[model samples]
Target: MSLPTWELIRAAGLTSYFLLFVSVSSGLLFSIKAAKPKTNQLLQVAHQSAGWFSLLFGLFHGLLLYIDTYKPYSLVEIFIPFTTKDEPLLNGLGTISLFIMVLLFISGDLMKKVGAKVWKKIHRLALPMVILISTHGIMLGTDSSNGWAIVLYASSLAIILSLLIVKLLLIKAKTKKVISA
Candidate 1:
């Protein structure tokens, strides 16, 4: 069946969101790799560039959703969780994920001012937000059933999870060394 023009526009918006997701994930990976003080400046530059791109695309995606007018969605529907009739659960989670995304973006900038401990606590929310975003995409997204989308989502999540695991192990090793000293 041929998609209507509205559907086409919606699809484009969703595709932009997906691209933002990928770019943000890659940026995070690059940032993690660049955590070393020296010899990883290139990754840091890539991280910063990709981060800005992701933010731009993400804003565009959200703005397109608001402006499309194909569907009768209110600002409440876009921003508030579980406020809409269509796909309440998914939309609710997505709303929360959006808030978390905003928090992540802000915290990235505030980390310098807030110090590492506070920033780490705030950044921990990224994991839940990622999971919520993944769930929201799969449950409410039109392309969720597509094999490539599923693979891309799963792989991105896996990469982030792996990075978290490595970070945890490194922390543990450091703690053990401190105790042994």
Candidate 2:
């Protein structure tokens, strides 16, 4: 038997959201590690290119929700989130996540003018935003019930979290070595 129409839409949305998440995370990781001149240049190019693609696909993913008639969502619900009477909390969090994503997109281009120190402070928001966005996806998304989606989401989380832990450990080790020297 063919899958239900709603299932297809959910799958599409989940896939698009996954791509957006990966693109942003990869861009951020590349940016943070890009210190050397040649590597920095390459990373910057990759970040910008991937960022644009993520934004484009993310917009399309959001629009698809509106287009899917089986579980049609209004423009307001699409943008505002949590406006859906059926699920207020998840939708509200999703709205906040969307706002954070917008800030990330805008601030990325303005990092130079904003000053590296100040931008670094602002960029810390990315971690929280990603967590919130992922939570929103897990809670409100239709694909939340799917085993594959859960596995993908969890894997992404594990990778990011592991990278962060390693980065911190390395920093601390370097600091200790410097003090001893």
Q: Best-fitting candidate, measured by lDDT?
A: 2
Assess each prediction's global lDDT (C-alpha) against the native.
0.67, 0.69
Off by over 4 Å in 2: 1-12, 24-46
lDDT of 2 at 44: 65
- State the lDDT of candidate 2 residue by residue for 1-181, as single tens digits: 5335465555555654666556655655664573677776676676566556655555555666676756767878878867866677766666666676677777777888888787677667767866876887788776677898889888888877876776777789889999999
lDDT score, residue 153, model 2? 88
RMSD (CA, Å), each prediction: 3.7, 3.8
User: What would you estimate as the lDDT of candidate 1?
Assistant: 0.67
Model 2 TM-score is 0.76
CA shift of 114, model 2, Å? 1.8
The runs of at least 3 residues in candidate 1 whose Cα sits more than 4 Å from the true structure, single-residue gaps closed, are 1-39
Worst 10 residues of 1 by lDDT: 1-10
